[model samples]
Target: MEETSITAEPGKQEIVISRVFDAPPDLVFKACTDPELISRWWAPESITTTVEKMDTRPGGMWRVTQRDAEGNEYAFHGVYHEVTPERIVDTFEYEAMPGHVLLETETIEDLGGGRTKMTDHLIFQSVEDRDGMLQSGMEEEMTGPMERLAELLQSLKQAAPAR
Candidate 1:
């Protein structure tokens, strides 16, 4: 699997992360939208997540809370703008910091040969907001969870009997 990230507008504050996973697109998509799977790998190892509500359809809303090791809780809420088997677009807001919103789009494509490519594009309201998120350690926060997902996928494959 290959991964790459780029900041489309360093000044305007847009972040994009692309990753190729050794899994089918449908499986990858399910890992993203399924609450159970989400909770299993949505945050870093030191954090625990609780899904307050999840409605995964266009115009539906999802709310989740993350509790850090220090017992501090952060809440995230989002309204789905578009929802399809292969793509999802949403508006996200951090309840802890109201008025700071982000528009996020996730696309999953089948790369064939049991591989999938997933791209996540995040747009902040302003460059400041984007910088603030980065400064707050967003990238580090995501790394562990993503690694966990990879491990989970590996385990799934290992447990499956041959053909």
Candidate 2:
């Protein structure tokens, strides 16, 4: 299992999430940015996720929808502001809460020996918005999907021929 860490300060308008994957940086980044691979592990047990649209270049757009067990659909859309082998910067907003947007930057660090670390920083519109997310079971919601991501990466690596 991957170790995941999340920190959110009471007054700071930022959320930091980090996790180490047992895969190389390039493969980890591919799993994150590839729509097909992403759709497989981006949702928790009770929710089904689908990539509605994905464009992985700077200024490109993406939209994904998650449907809960109760059939409630939640959509999120974002525009990529920057994209590099090691990092990505994007805007993120839930469709229901239009203006409560945030800037998210994801960095993948090569940790040597086939290990990769991903750090995600989310700068929210305000402290209140950040706090609200923290209080809304965000950590619990993320943990499962992140674990799923690790599993998916492990499987992917296993399937690849040894290099």
Candidate 3:
């Protein structure tokens, strides 16, 4: 399994998270845009994720909720500015933080030979907000979901029926 890499430069309000997956670009793209597929691997193993709304198109909106073992809920909602097979741009805001919105752009690269690389570029409103996100166990939360995503991708690939 490829490990996730998260980079956040000091004094900057940007973060870049990336990982390689052992699947094709189309499959990766589908896994990302499909709400059902998203809920399957969008959260940590200890949490349950529900896709409250998802409309993969420009000017569309999306909402997701995650519940932990203790039943604590975390809700996130966003608006899609752009959506395509290879790229997606959206605004992400956690309901708990109200107005701390961040712009996120995810790109899916076809690395050839049944491999794909997914990269997320996130820009926060300010350095403080970016630092707060980094300090809030964001890396673990991101990594856990990524690992789950890899597993899901592998299963989907295997289930493709010799095509």
Candidate 1 Cα deviation (angstroms), residue 84: 0.9
Lowest-lDDT window of 10 residues in candidate 1? 1-10
TM-score of each: 0.91, 0.97, 0.98
**Clash list (residue pairs), candidate 3:** none
Regions more than 4 Å wrong, model 3:
none
Best by lDDT: 3
| Model 1 TM | 0.91
Residue lDDT tens for model 3, 54-79: 99999999999999999999999999
lDDT of 2 by residue, 1-163 (tens): 6689999877899999999999999888899899999999988878889999999999999999999988899999999999888999999999998999999999999999999999999999999999888888999988888899899999999999996
Candidates' lDDT values, in order? 0.83, 0.92, 0.96
